[model samples]
Target: MKQNYIYIILFISFIFVTLYIYSSEIKEPLEDYDETKNPKLVFNGHWSGLFCNINRLVNFLVLYPNTREIDFNVLASKTHHKPFIGENIEIFSKLFQKYKEDIPIDTTYNYDGLDFTKFDLTHRKAYEYYNENRYKLEPYNKAFNKYLHLLPHLQERLDKMVNEMRSDCQQVIGVFVRSNALADEQPTGIMPTREEYLEAISKLDTFSKKTKYFLRIDNEEDYEFYKSKLSPIYETNIKRAKSNKGDAPHASGEYLSLEDLENTYLEIALLSHCDILVHCVSNMASAALYMNMNLVSICVSKPAAQ
Candidate 1:
């Protein structure tokens, strides 16, 4: 009888242990939990540009579906220099609607070093991952559209800017020319040159008087060059880093005014509204594509060796 009791106890203990392990496996592990029952993610910019940071945010949302809120204060405080002054969270709120609740500027939490291998979709490996997953990108795109809504005020501003550009124009050809300091920052031949851009634009039916160009060039010289070549060009009058001595202006370890930041946002926002985009591989271009994947684009690559 005692032997029978011991066997029964052992069987119950095994059952309990199995149940505990299964429940733990099913539950999403989080470092810290809030009252909302979801983990708050802290976005670390790593001194990246605005659109790159935005892309990282979207990628995080897609990969970690359980994240309901994100704090950017940590990024603001930790960077070598404040990229943009003023309320960071408020600026983000003006651009994107609240995903679930108001994204508080919680400084209590820090970036938990989450693996963001999937953040950079521009990488070659990401394309392979997409193909291996049966080429189904609907989920990722859906997450992007769901979380990336421009507030009505910003939307109104964007619409006004685009409408003015579209006025007296039948079509807008968006061009993103990555030049100036980027050539020094990136590996050789990674960034397309002025000749390459012009060659690609030459293939387009841009001779029409009704087609206007919206140039998103980084430097004044290239901007002027493209404007001269591609007549009737429109662009945001934002600050440009004409030097090749260091990083781009926004990421040059200098503090930028809130207005500068807003202009940068508007520039990318405007690029998405274009009927056709002609450009290279860049985060700004990538963000624009994410905004409007259906946009007809002509992506230029470096010339192959002879």
Candidate 2:
């Protein structure tokens, strides 16, 4: 067993060496697509979940277009789990390290006046248009996905979750359901009913020809609720990450260690790998798109006051 582990380590090391050599020797340049010609995008703003922050980063980059390097160290994660800043920096740094060779990523963090959040846009309509449906536009989605990729660590974690589902032939479908508690916080401002989500899932299953489902629920009640509802038809499951059950764990006053936070992201990483995803239009929902996964986003808002 120890010898096997050693061999695995050596194989991984060899693969990295081969990749670095391959990247270095490639002198052929695509002048049109060269980022060195473009101005760099310095990222620093609302660091939410994996999806939210990533979506914003992708949106901003797409809107701007010309960029040589992306500065992300200052863009801290705004997780409910952590109280102060710098908690999730390690994970972000890891992501930067894993993708730096491809995108020339800069891992230095800074919060001076240079923060992207401080930079306000005068044209709201133009900004919103490019940011919302930005990826679908020319050269945005294709370019972003090319540079952004999850590290092998996250990929291995996602693979473990998929294997745990133990589906023999059932196709995996991901369902992203937000809770009533987060209704006001959601971009859409309205929580889809259990029935509405079920309908969406049924349609997704039919559309994708999938038999298994992984319902990624934020609240505990919803987890049990969907498990019961989905079990009757498709092979359904949820990520059993710590604090994944019941109410708002972040607001629970518990200090979410770096490890716990990584577990939380592991769930998102797993969801990103699903065969098909039915999601609400939010940052968490948008994060999956960078992985080149299929997405169906549902957005419904509460009626405005008269």
Per-residue lDDT of 60 in model 1 = 61
Residue-by-residue lDDT tens digits, candidate 1, 5-78? 99999999999999877554323233223445455666555445566567666666665565666665324421
What TM-score, computed on C-alpha atoms, does each candidate reach? 0.70, 0.62
**Candidate 2 residues 1-306, lDDT tens each?**
999999999999999999876544332112123444444454554544444555555655554455555666433433533332344453454454333334444332222222333222111222222223534433435656755655677667667776875355356667777656555543345666777777766655454453667777776666777788765223333333333333565554544555555666666667766666666544555555454424433333223343
Model 1: lDDT to the true structure: 0.63
lDDT of model 2, residue 124: 23
Report the C-alpha displacement of residue 55, candidate 1, in angstroms. 0.8
Best candidate, lDDT: 1
